[model samples]
Target: MRSVKTLLVPYYEHPTERPDAWDALLAAADRLYGVVLNPASGPGAAPDPAFAVVAGRLRAAGVRVLGYADTDYGRRPHAAVVRELLCHRDWYGTDGAFLDQVSAEPEALPHYRRLAVAARTAGARTLVLNHGVHPDPAYAELADLLVTFEGPWDAYGSLAVPLWTAAHPRERFCHLVYAAPPDAHVAAAVQCVVPGAGVHPWGTLPHALEPIR
Candidate 1:
């Protein structure tokens, strides 16, 4: 049977450092929702030739290459965030933006909506907002995908699904669970569960996706 689950990977390692991991990710192109590209937390000071190459390769493989940009919970200047998106486009040729550190409060919706429009205007075909928790249902309108739950594996079971979220399509929400066990249950349509733990859990690949030795 074909795989029904799609993974939204947020791997933070550089291509040079994890060439094998990148290769493995490419091999699972069919199962990927998107691969978030983060060079120096956000796009670096200058265009990275290596990231550009990898971004191109991912795009060619029919995977969305998302440039990682921090929204700083609406505190960061809109212009600064837009600049990062532009850098991602110019430097890596990414077709999408993954807005991280997003605010979950209802009050921040307006700011995020404007930012979402800016991302699209900047040439982002796919936009994902990482709220890292359930936000106001209205927030769902601002992006293609919303990371509603992002936390350690232990917290996954105790997570309470708000009734408000039931109204939205499952595909609209995603959960990112790190330090996952072999049997970790991903609670959303889009899944990303990794076994790696500590400060850089995402530095490793998801259990279901591994490189052949």
Candidate 2:
């Protein structure tokens, strides 16, 4: 049977600030591919025991845990990026890395590809690129999922997915919308994206993830 496709959260809160984030994650674990864990500036070199416990719990519950790492739109040196990926692996035992600040240009493709390789080498089974827009189709080949849309709800209503993306499996695509409408509008937001697309809706800034039903 085909697996169910549901929400994917860009969970930006540190575990300390929102301990309830763990509960929210656990409640929706079955519907999620994973949640992104960001601490301090990013996933710092040392691990927090609290985060480690959360990661372990999420893993035991069969949900993938991804460490957040910013590439500064590929401006950061490759070695530095790789170090963060490895730190996430060794420190938090994350199953993958969510590469933030990804660029959509074709020229940046190779840079991301190398990062993907490094992530895999560092024990990341899943690599998600948060391009925050529809990127060059070539990017589709580099990561498991591309976050093609991320903004306020208004923009999401008019969002469009490139024809090339349609050629690939829908599960490889994700959408995130902040300042989302009321719960009544959730279905409409879900309908805006293609079937099998991972969707996340947040009602406020610095969005906290809601359980996906």
Native-to-model Cα distance after best TM-score fit, residue 67 in candidate 2, in Å: 1.2
Q: Tens-digit lDDT track for model 2 on 21-128?
A: 567777666766677776645677578787888888888988888888899999998998888877888878889988988999999888888998888888889898
C-alpha lDDT score of every prediction, in listed order: 0.90, 0.71
Clashing pairs in 2: none
**lDDT per residue as tens, model 1, 1-213:** 766637999999889988999999998988899999998889999998888888999999999999999988989999999999999998899999999999999999888988999999999999999989988889888888999888999899888889988787899899999989888878699979999889998898998786756
Deviating ranges (above 4 Å) for candidate 1 = 1-5
Best by lDDT: 1
